[model samples]
Target: MSNSASGMAVCDECKHKFQDLKAKRSFRFIVFKINEKVQQVVVDKVGQPGESYDDFTACLPADECRYAVFDFDFVTDENCQKSKIFFISWAPDTSRVRSKMLYASSKDRFKRELEGIQVELQATDPSEMSMDIVKARAL
Candidate 1:
């Protein structure tokens, strides 16, 4: 767990779990949240393997900020199977300003700890990170 100058620390469990998702295929997605009391980023929820994207999205609180990683698998034009890891910053408009600011500020350092993210998404609303947008970015 590395602590950035901003006083945000990435908990060890966060890194280990991400490695499991990225390399071991242990989870479909992982949701992360900052523990304001400790100023540390921690794993809040994990979508089990075989969980649909909708399930992953459902795990996010509509009125809070969260960071998540999804393992997206799709077929290419050549019919080749490929998977892309996405790092998403979810900050709904209804969330508190302080929460949003903390998440935004802590994102980079937290993301760096999880090594293999291939794409990044910042979404303030569901429309911004719709499946269509994710697919376009994946391709």
Candidate 2:
């Protein structure tokens, strides 16, 4: 079994063949629960290499998602061609200033945010992704 930074464990013999693995690229999905329904905002491309939170904020809408997930594309040390995906999600403390309450009230902004989140996921293997896994990661 291999342990990830998020404390997730996966026991895949094929994935463990290599000792070293690192993320070559990644994308962030921010999820929000509004009106009892969950929505998402996906940040697909960063404006610059090593973009900071400020850059992310500029791209982010005034509102925030209660949950977020980061999907990373990792390459094996033995063969760069051999790759896999790792997903990690988090829930931030938004009690201060009532971040959720301060969510953008603009309909257009919400529409755009939802659109971004609806973009296709970066998983190479579609079978590996499922709503159950996503829900588990959100916890």
Candidate 3:
């Protein structure tokens, strides 16, 4: 997955071949439009377990304005990108947009990750938590 953000990112640390199931690569970019230019952000990390994935993009932007806050807890709308495993989003430049960083895995794993994210984000200091909503799209 190619993301525009250079900050902390969610990377494919392991790329071993899988035989049990065909693994299709998926990507999500945390993006924000500033000055009419869409800026891609980094996904800091995911929590252990609810809601969705707890991805921390650019904290600078989320803290900068109310509109740029990206959520690591829950998504209120339908998925923007439709991947084999999860949903995604994109920008006009064909750059993958940030919504939720989804790892196609067991349904149980997905549920665990989602729940973990929700709990972690909720535990964070309200001031430190982000309000940015990532609209993920597939490229």
Candidate 4:
């Protein structure tokens, strides 16, 4: 990852650092449970370059058939491409604000704030990304 993209390096168990393989780019996804349903959001390259959340969300499955995966043309180099998955599940209590009662009322803002996970593990991968989950956070 570029110094400006990720900002800095961090450890695996550490939510503050993100480590990607020699791959020119990196991607991260944080999942939240909204109204007992799973609402996934992209966390990698969070504040980096080349793609927008709308563009990333576009790649997600539209069928609502348990998953949706799409690839963005957001390639850093000819060899570097980044994409994310947003999985949906039904359950009201399965949300980001599940524990943060202070931010519970502000669901949207709270969900966005609790961005601390990798891509959805259960999402159907038509093209296996083999993505190694990278934690994204600031410390």
Best by lDDT: 1
- lDDT for every model? 0.92, 0.30, 0.25, 0.29
Worst 10 residues of 4 by lDDT: 130-139
Q: Please write out the lDDT profile of model 3 over residues 70-125, one tens digit for every residue.
A: 23223335745332222122112222233222211111222222221222221113
Q: TM-score ranking from best to worst?
A: 1, 2, 4, 3
Q: How does candidate 3 fare on TM-score?
A: 0.18
- Write one digit per residue (lDDT tens) for candidate 4, span 1-139: 1123222222222223222311233433222222222232222223233555454444444332221222223344456665433322212233234333322333333323324322333333322322222112100
On TM-score, the stronger of 2 and 3 is 2
Number of backbone-clashing residue pairs for each candidate, in the order shown: 0, 0, 19, 10
Which candidate, 1 or 3, has the higher TM-score?
1
Ranking by lDDT: 1, 2, 4, 3
Alpha-carbon deviation at 46 in model 3, angstroms = 14
lDDT of 1 at 75: 94
Error of 1 at 127 (Å): 0.8
Top-TM-score structure, candidate number? 1
The alpha-carbon deviation from the true structure for residue 28 of candidate 1, after best TM-score superposition, in angstroms, is 0.4
Considering TM-score, which of the candidate structures 2 and 4 is the better prediction for this target? 2
Candidate 1 error regions (>4 Å)? 1-5
Clashing pairs in 2: none
Give per-residue CA lDDT, model 2, range 2-28, as digits (tens): 122222222232122111222233233
